[model samples]
Target: MTPHISRKTRVTGAALAAAGLLAAGITVGTAGASTTQTSAKSAMPIKLSASHRAELLRDASTTKAQTAKELGLGSQEQLVVKDVIKDADGTTHTRYERTFGGLPVLGGDLVVHTAKGGAIKSTTKASKHSIKVASTTAKIAPTAAAKSAQGTATKTLSAKGADAQTPKKVVWAASGKPVLAYDTIVKGVQKDGTPSRMHVITDANTGKKLFQYDEIHTGKGESQYSGSVELGTKKDGGKFTLTDDGRGGHKTTNLENSENGEGKPFSDDDDAWGTGKPDDPQTAAVDAAYGAGVTWDYYKTVHGREGIKGDGKGASSRVHYGDSYVNAFWDDSCFCMTYGDGEGNKKPLTALDVAAHEMSHGVTAATANLEYSGESGGLNEATSDIFGTSAEFFAKSEKDPGDYLIGEKIDINGDGSPLRYMDKPSKDGQSQDNWDSNTGGLDPHYSSGVANHFFYLLSEGSGPKEIGGVKYDSPTADGSKVEGIGRDKAEKIWFKALTEYMTSTTDYKGAREATVKAATDLYKAGSPEVKGVEAAWAGVAVK
Candidate 1:
């Protein structure tokens, strides 16, 4: 008779599916019926994935293997081994051993098991414990097809049994929440899952459903930035609507197809997009929510600012804009945030720092209003960069780490280098660290160095130092000695000065004066804090 072993014990914890347990060298015998458990003729060879093997061995909380071996499997044939985990890009497949009691068996009626995270459940009675199969299906829904037809094609849907479009009228429910002319249009159930349609109310001539494209699924597919803002046109007195509905949920009644096709300005906050497409609307909503929350809180709590204009309201952050546009930007006119996906290594620029940088532009415009050229322009640009970097470090996220570099996480440059470096602005082919009349001729990115260097010196002080894993050794124009103030304190001083002292035409000297005023106000004029500010500017060679 073939020797059999029973390896069983109370293996408690989260259930884990015993995946792919195909072994080499041994075959199962015919179904053996008897009081005693079946055993391996020699030794049953079991193969397991490396990751699963490691987890089994590391699970010190249980004595499953030992208990199983003790039941029946003799030391000779009882094999308790480990495997090497391969590249775990995103999926996990593991293998585990199953025994009747605590012994190794050639073949026995054991149950298969499956669990999530950790913990085991009852095993399946299948003959095979694990089997190799094709890779898992994509976790995200399919992409939506973009509308390519040039002109707008009007197709009237049969309103039979369908909810007729509601006209613009103010309606209030018992709850006091104004149900303003809300109408729901059923597009039918989504192919992947869930129900979708249009819900909007506007004037008959307003042109709702003007532009409808396949709504991109949130989160999983490539990053798409579809942000809309209605800014005051030369004719409309700058009245613009800033709606960042990246998920394609906003539905309006009247929209015109402009020459730019999808580029037509979104008229209202609720605009319908992604012509009937299956997408993870939930994921997209969460992403947008978190992004806006982080950006808003960063500005308000950290800087004591109200909103984008310090008005206590919130700015818009659109997500899942297009198919795969891997980038984000802040439009000056629209004053909205846009995000895109990565082209190769480049990722969407939706991080906290980027949002802060963009928002700060509004702050600068309201206060210093530094021109986008010359020394003043460089100051304007660097102000955004410095504040952006500060805002990034301000946020502490395990998902995304804060660094002194801009666009580092986004990978805008396929080489993995950051978009810009404040510690050493000269690393880029064009940024300038010192003030030069000729510096104004360079692009804003390069010309931004003078102010970038100034802020660096003001915040960290000149000389060899390390703040957040980044190394720095800033120089000074005249071998003058300067002391550095910690970043936390310095940020406060600059923000205060920017909002309180500086004006639209504030220049390099004006920044110096404004900052000095801020420092003296925060710390007594002759206090150590004041001295540090002076020294920092001195180190940067700022007179």
Candidate 2:
């Protein structure tokens, strides 16, 4: 009964300014590139147009049954469309999740790629084996499975009051052969003040624990506001509430030192909010709202993503969570972002990059649904860091300019050092700069250094360079020099791979293949961009 217990990992980011300003219209250069050239290139839309998107959705929605049958899946299996992506060449990629006999099939997600004529070109599946179980009946009772899960959570996570939810029968196909299992969720609070939602999978016949993973993803950051920023507020009678109708009606609330339930909505007599000081309660709300808005804009403008779930619906932001709680997290159950005040409630973890980092977690959940364990977990964390840094750069904040350093302004370590360095991940002493056999054995936060290093080298190339007044000297695993194809291209490639190709079980090697395929799709085969991606992955010893 040795269940894999996934722990909560930390993420960090820098401050942001000009919350209302949209980066979509602005053209910014990367590293030493010319601003004019960069702006023109950035202005060109890389995502599907409105009509094309509608068409792709329609096609995907209508073809799920036929596609599933064509794929030779079991008769009891059914496909549910999750996302659709259309390329400029009229190629379409549709992502789907699988279910067997009405039971959710874990790790059964797949992507179907179709040519311009609607012919299936290829498919990427999380699990290669067929999904069929001997019987749906569970030899072990659901109550017993729940109790075992709760006990496992209590023993491994030090969870307090760990109550188990009703167990659900699911097809456990993430690893090994497909089997009927009981999926139990244990809810409680961890010893570190982090909310716990541990998912435990137990084999039905053997009553043996298969795996367990925590739902809470924790991270740290600092908030620094230089001047006033515009916030999206809605007028209700006389007072204005912290709701942004412009961007999916996203709202910000105050937890007021409480660790449970949704907090009260922030309201003001006048639209004017925040004093740019942490002493005022409204100040933290302002920072949080601003960060959420910027993150929303970053995805909407840069990635053509409507919202966190890409349904044009907004996720709420909760600030001032717990007393002196120095971390922030994203909960998919609530579909909201939660922030905490640093030690003594002095520093709020509502920086722009942190907001982006946490929200990106939601995006990953809605797309790749990456399992938060092993190498897949490392890729999950790195995806957030990559997008967090990209959003930070997109904001073009002069106060805390974009750099390769993560959480540089937060000072979470009580020292002036940043939480992690993307250029050379090993600088943190705990992170790996290159991939190895044991990379997956490290904590996801530390193992994430491999992909972070790959992204940095891909964006800025290997060797020493200066960007936004910050000096970075990135090195390759093979000590070979690699040239960059710029951050804009790198971001697009990663985004495409995540939404269209990668799956729950994808690891470093799969990530390398996904990125290369994404690059080849965006840029023609054998293009410089494709070569750059291959070289970058090799730089991280992924090859």
Question: Which candidate leads in lDDT?
Answer: 2
* Global Cα RMSD, each model: 29.5, 7.7
TM-scores, each model vs. reference: 0.48, 0.91
Q: Single out the weakest 10-residue window by summed lDDT for candidate 2.
A: 5-14
By TM-score, the best candidate is 2
Count clashes in each candidate, considering only residues at least 3 apart in sequence or on different chains.
Answer: 66, 1
lDDT of each: 0.42, 0.82
Q: Which runs of model 1 end up more than 4 angstroms from their true locations?
A: 1-288, 320-326, 344-346
- Tell me how candidate 2 scores on lDDT: 0.82
Compared with the true structure, what per-residue lDDT tens digits does model 2 show for residues 329-414? Answer: 99999999999888889888888878989899999999898998889999999999999888888877656667778888787777
lDDT of 1: 0.42
What would the TM-score be for candidate 1 when compared with the true structure? 0.48
